[model samples]
Target: MRIAYRVETVRAAEQELIARLPDGALMQRAAAGLAAATAGMLGRVYGARVVVLAGSGDNGGDALYAGARLARRGAGVSAVLLAPDRAHPDGLAAFLRAGGRVADDPYDVLAAADLVLDGITGIGGHGGLRPDAVPVARAARGSNALVVAVDLPSGIEADSGEVLGEALHADATVTFGAYKPGLLVDPAHAYTGAVRLVDIGLEPHLPSVPDCEALQHADVAQLLPVPTGESDKYRRGVVGIVAGSARYPGAAVLAVAGALHGGAGAVRYVGPAADDVIARFPETLVSAGPPAKAGRVQAWVVGPGLGDAPGVEEVLAADVPVLVDADGLRGLDPAVVRDRAAPTLLTPHAGEAAALLGVSRAEVESARLRSVRELADRYGATVLLKGSTTLVADPGGRAPVRVNPTGTSWLATAGSGDVLSGLAGSLLAAGLTARDAGSVAAYLHGLSARHAANGAPLTASSVASSLTNAWRDVYA
Candidate 1:
């Protein structure tokens, strides 16, 4: 698993690491890594034109020192000092000795540079760029140079991943010490193109638990359910899906498609679209009554296209784990969901989440991490915030939130969420916690969409059909 720490935790760890090393040792280690990464991006750095956007702090010191190294290698390196008087004295002297010159005009140097190092801000930076440095940042962005941000893209909240105002968009970001939460999430994640972590010996100083984590293939593979020789259809677990209606029978079919491949022994579907579901997936156990009368089930997935379905209350009243999505989320009583003893997982897009929280959609989108955590706290349920980045948050807010890294824009198609609900519910039935079910479902759902689309437009059914391939790929 890839983990990310908050800015405060990273700073504490950096302090511990710096104290153990000799004077200027940590800075030299960081600058060497930065210089090497910049050199690799330039391929032949011997005669490349490099420009460093240096600010007032240690972040600026890092850029200046890296620029000095590049200058010594025969590269024409220029430093655009945003805070000239307060620049790092030792770093500036080294840069001058290595044949690096101060830029007469930021825009002119940026326009002709082959590579730009964005050291304008660090993890301590709060809001957007300073007024005096705005034009230089803009010029670097507008230029043809391969923009590389040091540590993080300037103007982003390093801890929250919130881009308050104008932020630098880098083609690549070379972060030092450890990965920050901002680099792993959006809208800051969107500004950070490709991220590469440069370890500066801060691992032993960091806490065991991180603020957020992204699971890899091995982690998901271990979490997936595997049937033993003693396991039977009933022993493996049954997932009951309460979805669809007379008007939208396709929702039931898509949900069943996802559930059939979700490692569950049997899928019991209860809805008005029994005929449509049976026609598509003949293996499904169909029932038209409420979920209480649908026989025994380990978990329940409620409300996909359930328009005015009378079973929502009955399912919510059931003792089994429940996953609520789509139309079922409308007018959902937080008190009722929080009172449940069994695990509950809620999957909502930005609009649904906004409506549930009584906030604007833009608010949820801008601060996704905050929105997910808030929803989890209010509902007392695991919330899977679905959008460009899928986040799974625990209700108690003790564990780190999970950020899904595998996703394609093609998942925005119709009926995609219905499939996800079924898959997650199946996992819950297979004995994973609400947090694991939601996060693993998101990971598989995104990967399946990418496999199905292959850079083309794909329907929700295609994504569902590719789940088996996605599962196999994860294992492989």
Candidate 2:
């Protein structure tokens, strides 16, 4: 599994590695790797015009020393020090001795550079580019040449994946140690185009527990539940869905739409909208009572379009893995959730999240990672906060939080979330842990949305129809 430690953990590992190595060995390793990556981007280091936007920390030192390597290779390299007095003395000397020029007028060389290296900030940075680094970053953005970030894109919160201020948009970023969460999440991820890890022997010291993780193709494939030849229909898994009402009977259909195709052996739907659900999906076994009264099921999905129904209490009290969404979020009590005997996953949008936190929607959106974690802790369940970038956090905090990378903003349409609830619920029924089910379902749901629309406007049914292709992709 790919792991991403927090900044503090990464620093501890770095310090341990640095102390064991000979003098300046760690810096040399980082710089050499950076220089090599830059050369690859430029096609040829010799005679290439390269500019380094150096900061005050080791990040700047990495850039400056890398520039020295380029100078030794006959590249016309220059350093524009943001903090001239605080620049690394050894790096500056090495660059100057290797024929690299130091210019305090930042924009002079950056405007005409063939490539720009952003070393303005590192993982330690909490806010945007310092006032002076702005112009040089802007110049790099406007320039036609390639822009490469030394460690991570400047002006992004390395730990939280939040964009603090105006960030430099990099064509590619060469990161040391391991992948930071910001590089995988959105907003900040948008600024970080492509990320390449430069192995500097830091993995052995990194903590096994990652702060967050992004699923790769192989990882997703492994997590997906596969049916075996020996397994019978009942042995696979059965899902019971408690959703929809007369006013929103379509939600019941959509939820069943996802559940029937989502690898579930059988689906038992219980709600007032049984007629509509049966009309759309006659295969579903519709019950007239609540979920607990419904027949056997490996897992349950509660709340999509439930609309303050009186029977929700019975559904919420079931003794199986349960997924809560939409109307299920209304006036929820932590005590009721905390008392549950099984794992529960709560899926909420910003508005529902804001309601849970008793804060404004903007506050929840502003700090989505924090909000998701707080909600998980407060409700004592797995929380999936849906937005431009969906986040999944487990209440136990054992697994690293998952940030979905494949999603389209067009998925904001009605009934999309209902389908997500069904997909995730079915996965939970199929015997994956709540965390795995939620994240994997979200991955598939987002991919289906992308496939259904392919840049065109799409309805919720169209998204559900495309799930077959997405499932095939995971298996492939």
Candidate 3:
């Protein structure tokens, strides 16, 4: 699992490490890492033109010292001190001694630079860039040089992942100590192209738990249930799906398609689309009326294409874990969900999430991390906020929010969410917690989309079909 800590936690860890180390030791370590990473990116550092955007903080000192190292290796490095007066005296002297020059015109140096280091602002910066620095940052962006941010890009809320205003977009970000929440979540994540973590000996002092986490293939493999010789259909667990209406039968078929490949031994589908679902997937145990009468199921998935049909209440009333999606999320009451004894998973896209929170879709998109966390706490249910970067946040905010890293935009097709809804519900039936189920489902679903698409546009059915390969990929 890849974990991300908040800025304050990282700061605390850095302080602890710095206290025990020699004076300037911590900063030197950071500078060395930065220089090495920058060198690797440049490939041939000798005679390469490198421009460092230095500010009035330690972040700037790291860049300056890194520039000094590059200069020593025969790179033509120059510093554009955004705050010349407040720049690190020691770092400045080192750069000067190493044959680095301070640029007379920032634009002139930025224009010809092969690489640009954005050290104007660090993780602590808020409310965007200073007025004086905006033009220079914009120029850096407009330049042909590869932009690499120091620690984090300027103007993003490290904890919340919110972009306050105009921010510098980096081709890559070299974050030290640990990963910040902003580096993983979107809005800020979009600004960061590729992120590289440089260890500065801070993890030993940091907390065991992180603010955010993303499951890798190995982690998901451990959570996935495997059957034994004694396992039967019932023993392996059955997932009940309450989806599709007369208006939309494909939703039910796609949902069942995903469930069959979701590692659940059996799938019991209860909806008006029974005939349509049976026609496609005969293995599905189809039923009518409420989900409670759909025989015994370990978990229930309700909502996709429900279209004002009545099943959300029936499924929620069941003692088993329930996952609500699509139409099931329409005008959902918090009190009802909060009062349920069993774990409830609510899967909502940005628009639906906005409606549930009484906020605009734009607000939800802009601050996805905060919105997902708030929704989970408000409904007292686990929330799977579906987007480019899928996030699964459990109720009460105790656990780290799991971010799904695998995905392609091709998964944005119409019935894709329906497939995801069933996949997650099946995992729930297989005995995974709401958080685990959601995150694992998302990971597989995204990998399936990638496999199915393969650079071409894929349909929901194709994604469902690719699940077998995706599951195998995890094991491999």
RMSD of 3: 0.9
What TM-score number comes out for model 3? 0.99
lDDT of 1 at 321: 93
In terms of lDDT, which candidate is strongest?
3
The digit string of per-residue lDDT tens for model 3 on 49-113 reads 99999998899989999999999999999999999999989989999999999999999999999
Q: Please report how far candidate 1 places residue 394 from its true position, in Å.
A: 0.2
In model 3, where do residues sit more than 4 Å from their true spots? none
Question: lDDT for every model?
Answer: 0.93, 0.87, 0.93
TM-score for each model = 0.98, 0.94, 0.99
In model 1, what is the error at residue 463, expressed in angstroms? 0.5
- Return the lDDT, model 1, position 311: 75
What are the per-model C-alpha RMSD values against the true structure? 1.0, 2.0, 0.9
Candidate 3 weakest ten by summed lDDT? 286-295
